[model samples]
Target: MDLELEGKNAIVTGGSKGIGKAIAKELAKEGVNIVIAARNKDLLDATAKELSKETNQRIIPVICDTGNSEAVTKMVNIAIENLNSIDILVNCAARPLVKVLNHFHLKHRMTIFGMI
Candidate 1:
């Protein structure tokens, strides 16, 4: 089951848990070094340590809120700084739109949907 991904680098957003974490683990098992981003630092750190140990690949944890453009930018910068270049990007980060809709005005909602 060689993916031929040895030494490749990737970033997996929302990777602290669930599907994203699963994806990161598989990629690491395939020999890819990864950066796993999430809002929860504790979860991110724990996941990173666990995955690195299990797969024998570099797993860096980065705290990030994907909804914020600045935070995303910072996360990308950190990934590039650590991994040198990005070979893959798995954008799994998301929030419930229902909760978001409750918090924004109509105009901002349009922006959220990229209609603005």
Candidate 2:
């Protein structure tokens, strides 16, 4: 299918794994230049390398923690600098853990890897 996304640019957060990673891969497959941000530099680098090789598209990895406003700004700047545009924005990253108390018990929920 033609997504008409060739040469488009995108910034995908929490893109090192799970849904974010999947979105980045799909975008790359559709011929989009993508910038993926996560807190783990090593993981980001490895994912970037793997996706770039698989899709034959440019995938830039950035170390970022979206909880920080400065990091978000920096991530955007980096994406624009690398991809030259931000036609798409996929905010797939989320808190890794959430603990809640139910009516009778406690529950632990994981977001991102398990969350996404």
User: Highest lDDT: which candidate?
Assistant: 1
- Worst 10-residue lDDT window for candidate 2 reads 103-112
Per-residue lDDT of candidate 2, residues 10-112 (tens digit): 9999999999999999999999999999998999999999999999999999999998999999999998787777999999888645432451132233432
lDDT of 2: 0.89
Report the C-alpha lDDT of model 1 over 1-116, residue by residue, as the tens digit: 99899999999999999999999999999999999999999999999999999999999999999999999999999999999999999988989898767767776777778664
Which stretches in model 1 have alpha-carbon errors above 4 Å?
A: 103-116
TM-score of 2: 0.82
How far in Å is the alpha carbon of 17 misplaced in model 2?
A: 0.6
lDDT of 1: 0.95
